[model samples]
Structure formats: structure tokens, C-alpha cells
Target: MHRQIAGKLTGPVTKWIVLVGAIVLVGIMAPLNGKLIDVQNNEASSWLPQSAESTKVVEQLTGTVDPNDIPTLLVYHRDSGLTTADLAAMDEDAKEIEQIKGVTAQGAFSPNEAKALIASGAKVPPLLSDDDKVAFVAFTFNFGKNGWQDIPDAADKVRELSKIDGVDVHLAGFGGQASDASEAFEGIDTNLIFITLLVVIVILLFTYRSPVLWVLPIISAGFSYMISGGVVYLLAKYADLTVNGQSQSILGILVIGAGTDYALLLIARYREELRRHEDRHEAMAFALHRAAPAILASAATVVIGMLCLVFADLNSTAGLGPVLAVGVGVTFLIMVT
Candidate 1:
């Protein structure tokens, strides 16, 4: 059964058809790479269990407020403590932020306001630290709809507007974290793909000891990664699959690693069959017959193990299950083809 299957698959007509089909598929899916990050959800509530109290609060607040608003804390500090001028400058900066679209300015303290509160015998504004060396201004910025894609832009505007001379400014809170994370992930996928390719080429060159032969596994792995990415993107878009930076990054690595392993196994068996059979088609048939079972079992084990994460309480973990299982399954298909 296996030999017949392999013989049909290796036929010249079938080979060309598969090659053309693969090229067309890749062309259609290549544009999806840029769209993946746009669909990603980084909200803390997305990852937590629905049963958690925090998650419940988030759910309750979603209907009543701008649930997509991210809080930004601007901290200004000076070793000598803020002068009256610094406080006045901070108030003006806060007002300036209000003019920037999407910002809900809050809790800006000027020296005047501070003095008035003190004179009124009310507790001083919490903006000033006890040491009087640091003060904070806060704002909530709205990112309408699927807003994480706008976080980096919003953070940049805040950082640019918060700058004041004679005082060091630091951005804190969720908005700041999103900006830092965006910077870190920028170009990460491209660099990772480049490094994976380089490493695979080096290892394949050493293993095959033939310049022409090393390209085969690399091409197969590349196709697997692209197809896996596209499939995962669809799942995330339509299935409420919770993918964040971490899972998306790992998906690329998983496909390349597993695809290479399967390719090596198949290529070794094909080489051995070539030595024993005079016809290349017959050689491929026997090779796949001998090697496909073990490869299938290995891939199935990985897929089942990964899919078991669907039982996890955390949405991120559950999402990773299907994403990686799809990656491994696709890798297996590309290697065998």
C-alpha cells in the first residue's frame, strides 16, 4: 500500500502538479505575514480565565467604559526636587496632552493646585511623592476597536509630549510596557527566520556533504513555516484563538525544527533505497514505504501532546495548543510531499 502510494506521488506528472500548486499557495499566503501582528491581542484579560475576579471586573467594565483605553503614567523627577517652575511646566504639559487626539488627561498638579489643597487642609494630591523628588501625571488613551496595533503609536506621542527640560521623564504603566514590547518584537520575526534558515543551511550542508542536496530540506522547511503561519492566522482571526507575541514567535521555530527532523529522516531512507534500486522512482517508493510509518508516528505524538494543552485554564496556553499542532502537522505534510 505504501509503495504504491509513494510510486504515484513520485511520478513525473504528480511531481510537477504538486510543485505548481505549492508555488501558487505560497504566493497567496505570503501577504498574511504582516497581518499576523495586527490580529494579535495583548490585553491581560484575554489571557486570564473567565472565572478570575479581575477578568470578571474587566468584563463588567467593558460595557460601561472605553475598555480599550490604556493608562499611561508620566513620572518626572529631579534630584533637587521640583521647583515651582517645574510644577507649572508639568501642568502645561498635561494640558497639551489633552489636545492630542485619543488622550483622556487626568491628575495634573501645578504648584498653585498643590498650595490650594494644602491651604484647604485637604490631603495633598497623590501625584507628589513623600520626598517631593518625583511627581506623576496620568492619562488614558483610547485605541478604538482592535486597538493593540495602535499602542506603539500612542506611546510614542505620549513620550514625545511628556518631555520637559530640567526634569527626567519616564513612562510607566500598560501603555509604556506595550511600547517597549513593540520595539522589542519589531524585526524579531524577520531576524528569527533568517537565523533559522542560516542554521538549517549550515547543518544540512554538513549532513548532506553535497551543495545541491542541502537545498531540499531548507526549501521544504521554509514552505512549512509559511503554510503554518497562514493557518494559525486564520484560526486566530475566526476561532477566537488567543495568540500573543510569545506564541507567534514559537510557531516559526516549531515548524522549522520539526520539518527539518522529518526531512532528514526521509532523505536518509531515500539515499539508502537509491543504492539498492536501479530506478529512482522505485527507490523513492521503497524509501517512503520504509520511512513514512516512523515519521507519521513521531508527528502524531507531537500533535497529540500539543493539542492536550486545550484543557488548560489559561487562554494563551489553550491557544498555543492548536497553533503549534497546526505547525507540526503542516511540517509533516511538507516534508513527506
Candidate 2:
């Protein structure tokens, strides 16, 4: 059955060229989608540098969290040799803070850091609670009172001090904290996309028992996401928009479920028509005629539901809404072919 279809489709060169072209397109568009935009290690790995725009974006998302202050907490448990003498070790940092301009305050908090994090309401603590194992310190960097980048070199200085010996320390806050979060979430997005594709492949393999059947939906959905992602990147770069942490997961759900669903609906009808009509072309025509309406309706409903996100005030939700909508729309369009 597979060979019959392949023989009828014409030259292998045309198929090969089209297949290679698609892969090239996917590679190009993956970064534009804003999910795969990592330039790790080398000089370029520092793609999105800390700047006024980044500071402002963080500020917008975290209301009342001052970006210029660039605060990081040093938490040590009471059991981690954090006695009065160890607490005095923080005074060593006072010299580092004084030497570094825009460095506002550096002080040690005993086990009381937990209480401060829970009560002070300045910023939420990133680490977990372990009162016996942790002593905390808040290092406030005054970026010249201008903004995060203006404190001259506060984050760099914080990184420098984090290297102090004896006690274990982590330099965290708006700047370093955001970077850590981004790094942790990076693998999850790609895994989500792959998992979506994996589920689709499993469905196809079980239903068709043919490799060719799996290829169709994979090519269709992958290309649609690639194109949509490229457009997303352009929007992010030029329009100053953002694709938040879960944006790719949203795209994965839409692309995988809808793409496989469209393919499933079409294939089911095609099989039904094949049993009644002897000709493959006639069966295809029948299937297309019957399945197209349902596909369109499903796509329409998805678009309508997602567009509602435009009314949301949170930029992250609003950002994900359109990217996912575009991805669904792209899947619908690709299914047309």
C-alpha cells in the first residue's frame, strides 16, 4: 500500500528536495518562535544582555519589585557553622560592598532570614525553608538609583562576592534569579514539544502500522510550528513582545493535538471511502470533502477561545495567547495541503 502511493507520487528527487527544504525551514524558524533562542557558552551565549529594556520588563511583571535594587539573599542554616563569628563573616562583604559603587547594604540575618522573607514583603525567597540549615542575608545593590544596569556594576560585584570561602552562598535576586529560572525552564519547553510529537507518532504507528503514515502529520505539524515560531520571533524582536515560560507548552498542546486530530479525521474518512470506492483518488476526494468542514470548525473554535486572552492584563498570558492561536491557525492551514 505504501509503495503504491509512493510510485504514484512521482520522482523521488522532488520528494527528497521538498523534505530537505522543510527541515532547513524548521531549523531557521525554531529560534524565531522565542522558545529555542539560546546562544549558550561562547560570547554570543550572552544573547539578551542586561539592559534598560530588560530591567523595565522585569519591573512590569513584578510590581513593587524595584529592579535597580538588584537584591540577592544569602541564606545559611544555624547548623552550617553560622555562629556569631560566621555571622561576622558577612562583615567581610561589607568591605566588598563599600568598595563597589551603588552597593547600598550588606548585612547578615541569622535564622531570622526566614521570618524576614515571610514577613518583610520586599520580595519572595526563592529557596526552600530549612531554618536549621540556613542563614540569610539580603545584599541590596543600588544601581545609582537609576535602574538595574545603572548601579554601575552591582551584579558583577555580587558574582565576585559569591565566590567567598568557608560558607556556602548563592547570589540570587532579580538579575541572577531571573537567569536561573530561564535556564531551568529551557529544557522543559523543548521536552514539551518533543513529547507532543511523540504522542502523535505513537497514535499514527498504532493506527496505520506504516512509517509513511507517521511522516505526514509530523511534517505538517513541525513545519506549521516552525513558520509560526518564526513569526513569533519577529513579533518579539520588533514589537518588544515576550513569549513567557509556558508559551511553548501551549503551542505543543495545540500543534500536537490539533495536527494529529486533523490527520486522524481525514485518514478515517479516507479509509471509509476506500472501502466503497475502488479508486484511491476518488476516495481521497470523498474524504477531503467530508473531513474539511469538521477540521475548519475545530480550528475556528480554537481560534475563538484563544483570542479571548487578548482581554487579559497579564502580559505573559496575553503573549502566550496569540502565539498559540497562530500555531493552531498554522496547523489548520497546513492541513489544507
Candidate 3:
């Protein structure tokens, strides 16, 4: 039954149809690769379980508390105690930071405030460490829905402007973490795809021992990744699906690796069939007939297993379900086709 279907599908005239369809599919999806991250849900609240205390607290605070504000810290340090000039410089730095767009910097606690706290028997926040080697500025931002997006830019501006001759300034807290995460994901689309392809190419070259053979699988895997990204992006955008850097990164690897596996198996069977059959189409038809079941079974198992993550309480885990299922499903179709 499989052989009959393959025969019709791989027939000389039908092969061109498949080829054109694949070309069209890939052409439409290629541009979507760069848009995956645009729909990613990087905010921590998106991942936590709704019933969790932290999640509840976050929910309660969302509209009532620092609704629009993102608190940030800037630590300044020196080996020697801060001098009068250093304190003055610190004050100036805070003022400059206040001028940053999308930010609202606050001045550090003054000496008078510190004295009042000490007199009141209140344990002040240890902005200045016991050794007097550290002091920090605290601030908040009211960037609204897009506050997280501005974190990296605001942090860069803070770092650039807070420089002192002898004091070291460091951005800390949520804004700092956002800046770090932004840096980490800066070129993830290009870098992750390139590295995955490079490694796959190397392995495929050795596995097939044929230059031309490796290229086909690589192209197929690349298409699979592009399709997966496009599908995931659409789902994320319209369906309110949760996407994050971790899930998106894993989606690329899963598509490439799984697609290549299917490609290798099909190619091996095709090569064997080529020895027994004169026509390439007939050979591929027989190869697909013989190999399609195992490949489909494996892909189904993986897709089903990943889809089970939909039951997870955490949004990130739940998001991985459809994300990876889409990847494996795309890879399977591309490889089988």
C-alpha cells in the first residue's frame, strides 16, 4: 500500500509537482525565521504557574503596585573609602542616568538619611558595605508594557554614563537581568542556525561519504527548521502561545537533528534500492515504501511525547509542546516527501 502511494507520488511528472510545491512552501516560510523571537514571552510571570504564591503575588502587584515601574539597582564600588569627590561624582552619575530615555533614576540615600535611620535604630539597606568599599544607586522605570524591551538600551546608557575615574559601576536587579538576557539572545536566530547547520553538514559529510548527498539532507533540514519557525511564530502571534528563548532555540536543534535522522535513513534505503533498480524514481519509491513506517513511527512517538507537555503547569513547558511538535512534524513531512 505504501509502495503504491510512493510510486504515484514519486512518478516522473509527480516529482516535479512535489519539487515546485516544496520550493513554494520554503520560499513563503524563509522570511519568518527572523520573526520567531518577536512573539517570545520572556517575562517571568508568563512562565510561573498561576496557583503559585509568587505568581499570585506578581498578579496582585501587576496593577496595584509598581504597575508600570521596573526596579533597577546600580552598584558602585572602590577599594578605598569613597572620597568627597567620589560622592559628588556618584550624585552626578545618578543625575545623568535620570536623563536616559525610558528610565527614571533615583538619587542614592543621602548622609542625612543614613544618620536618621541609624538614630531610629533601623537597619538601613547596606548600600555601603561594612568595609565602605561599596555603595549603590536604586531607581525605577515606568516604561509600561514595553519596559522590558527598553531594559537593554537603558542599561547600556546607564553603564556608559555612570563611569567614574576610580569607581566601578554595575547594573543589577531585574533590568540588569533583562539586559543580560537580551545580550544572550542578540544573534540567536543566525548563530544557532549557522552552528547547527555547520555541525550537521560535518556529520552528514562523514556519514554519506558523498559531497552531493550531504547537501540534500542539509537543505531539507534547513527547510524543516524554517517551516517550524514560521508555524511556531504564527501560533505564538495569533493563538497567544507562549514562546521563549529556550523553547525557540531547542526547536531549531530538534528540527535539524530529527530531519537529518529521517533523511539519513531514507537516503540509505534509497541507495540500497538504487543498486537493485535502474530508475531513480523507482528506487526512491521502494525506499520510501520500506523506510517510511519506521520513520513515521519514530516521529509520531516524539511528536506525541512532546505534545504531552501541554499538560504542564508551567507556561514554558506547555509552550514547548506545540513548538517542538511542530518542529518534528515539519521535519517528518519534509523528509518523507
Candidate 4:
């Protein structure tokens, strides 16, 4: 059965048809691959089970408290005591921050307001430290569903507006952390792809010992990555599949690793067959016929293992399984073809 299938695929007319078809399919999938990042659900609740207490509380407070609200603290410190000028600058900074599109004005206390509240016995926490060398502004920002994406810019704007001579300003609290995280993940996809490709190329070069021979596997891996990313994008967008930064990054690594593994198996078998058969096409057909079973078995094992993650209670873990399974499955199809 494998031999017949291999013969049909490697036949004189069918070979060109398969090549053209694969190329056309890759071209169609390219754009979808580029859009995979847009649908990623990175919110904290996304990782939690719907029945979890935290998730339930978040759902209960959805309307009363904005789910998108990110509490932020702008802390300022000076080795010396803060001057009247510093307090005035901080007040001005608070006013400007409230003007920022996503920043909420409610409950955002400026230095003057905090001092007034303290004097009026309103039970507000003192914004200034007892030593009078430190102070902070407390506020919240709502940037809708994907607030994490906008946090870095908002934090930057606050820093720009809050500049005071001899005082060091720092962003703290959830907004600050989210801003840092967003920045960290900003170029993750590009960096991971580049590093993965470079590592694979070097390993393939060392293993194959031929400058030109390594390119085929790399090309095959690249096609597999593109196809997998496109398919994952569609699943996330339409099928409600969860694809976070971690899973997206892992997808590339799995595709490259699996694709290269399958390529090596086929290449080794093809090389052995070449020594026995005079015709290159006949050797390739024999190679595919023999290697197909092992390659299929390996891919199936990985796919089943990944699918088992679907049983996990954590949404992130459950989603990771299918995402990786899709990658390995796509890689196998591309390499086999």
C-alpha cells in the first residue's frame, strides 16, 4: 500500500503536479500566518477555568468594576526632602495623566487632593511618605479587552509627563507589570522564528556536512511553519481555539523540530536506496515507501500526546495541546509531500 502510494506520488506527471499544488497552497496560507498574533487571548482570566472562584468573581464584578481596569502607581522618590516645587509638578503630572485617553479620572488623587483629604479626615492613605522623601499617584486605566497592548505607551506617556528635577519616577502595580510584559512579548514571534531557523540551520549543516544539502530540510520546515500558523490562526479566529504567546512560540519550534526529523529519516532512506537503484526517481519512491510507516507512526504519537492536553483543566494547557498537535501534524504532511 505504501509502495503504491509512493509510486503514484513520485511518478513523472504526478511529481510536478504535487510540487505546483504545494506551492499554491503555501501562497494562500502566507497571509493567514501573518495574522495569527491578532487573535491571541493573553488576559489572566483566559488561563483560568470558567468554574474557578477567581473566574467567577471576575464575572460577577464585570459590570460593577471595569474588567479592563488596570490599577497603576506612579512612584517618585528623592534622596532629599521633596520641595514645594516637586509637589506642584506631581500635581500637574496627575492632571495630565487623567487627560490620557484610557486613564480614568475617578479616584485618581493628585498630591494636593490627597493632602486635602488627609486634612479633612476622610481616611485616605497619605500619598507622601513619613520622611517626606517619597510619594505616589494612584489611578486606574481601561484600554478595553486588549489593554495590555496599550499599557507600554500609556506608561511612557506618564513618564514623559511626570518628569521632575532631582526626582526619580517609577511605574508600579499591575499596569506597570503589564507594560513590561507587553514589551517583552512585542517581538517574540520574530525573534523565536529567527533563532529557531538559525539553530536548525547550524545543526543541519553540522549533521549533513554538506552546505547545500541542509537547505531542503530548512525550506520544508519553513513551509510547515507557515501552514501550521495559518491553520492555527483560523482555529483561534473561528473555532474559539486559545493561542497565547507561549503556544504561538512553541508552535514554531515544534514544526521546525518535527519537520527536520522527518526530513532526515527520508533522506537517510533515500541515500541508502540510491546506492541500490540506478534511477533517482525509483530510489526516491523506494525511500518514501520504506520511510512512510516510521514517519507516520512518529507523527501520530506526537499528535495523540498533544491532543491529550485537551483534558487539562487550565485553558492555557488545554489550548497548548491542540496548537502543538496542529503544528506537528502540518509538519508531517509537508515533509512527507
Tens-place lDDT per residue, model 3, 1-337, is: 2778999888999988987998898888878867787677777877888678898887888787865566778888888876667766766776777777876544345333454578899987645567777777777766765654667777888898788888877889777877888887776856887898899999988888887989888888888888888988889889988998889889988898999899989999999999999999999999999999999999999999999999999978988899999999999998888
Q: What is the TM-score of each predicted model, taking all chains together?
A: 0.89, 0.61, 0.87, 0.92
* lDDT tens per residue, model 4, 1-337: 2888998888888988988988888898889998887788888877998678998898899889888889999998999888888888888888888988888758467667898988998988888998989898999988886686778898899888888889999999888898899998988878988898899899899889998999999988998888889999999999999989889998988898899999999999999999999988888999999998999999999999999999988989899999999999989888887
Q: Report the Cα lDDT for residue 299, model 4.
A: 97
How far is each candidate from the true structure, as Cα RMSD in Å? 2.8, 9.9, 3.4, 2.2
- Taking the tens digit of each residue's C-alpha lDDT, what string does model 1 give over 1-337? 2877888877768877877888788777766755778778778876897678999999899899777887777788999998878888888887777777767545344445666778899886667787879988777777664556666776677678777787999888777886787777876767887898789889989999998998888888888878888887888888888888778888888888888899899989999999999888788878888898999999999999999999988878888899999999988987887
Against the reference, the lDDT scores of all candidates come to: 0.80, 0.62, 0.82, 0.89
Give stretches of model 3 more than 4 Å off.
65-68, 104-133, 142-150
Report, for all candidates in order, the number of backbone clashes: 0, 9, 0, 0
Q: Point out the worst 10-residue segment of candidate 1 by lDDT.
A: 104-113
RMSD of 1: 2.8
Residue 163 miss distance in model 4 (angstroms): 1.9
The candidate, 1 or 4, that scores higher on lDDT is 4
Where does candidate 2 stray beyond 4 Å?
1-28, 34-69, 76-180, 276-282
Candidate 2, residues 1-337, lDDT tens digits: the string is: 2334433332344445646766777788876664434211111111233344764566475577643455656544444545556555555654555566665655433334435566777575533344445555565655532342243245556556745455567655554564355455546767887887887888899988997888988878878877777876676667755564466567766787888888888888889989998877667666767777888899989988887976665556666677788888878876644
Model 1, residue 33: displacement in angstroms?
3.7
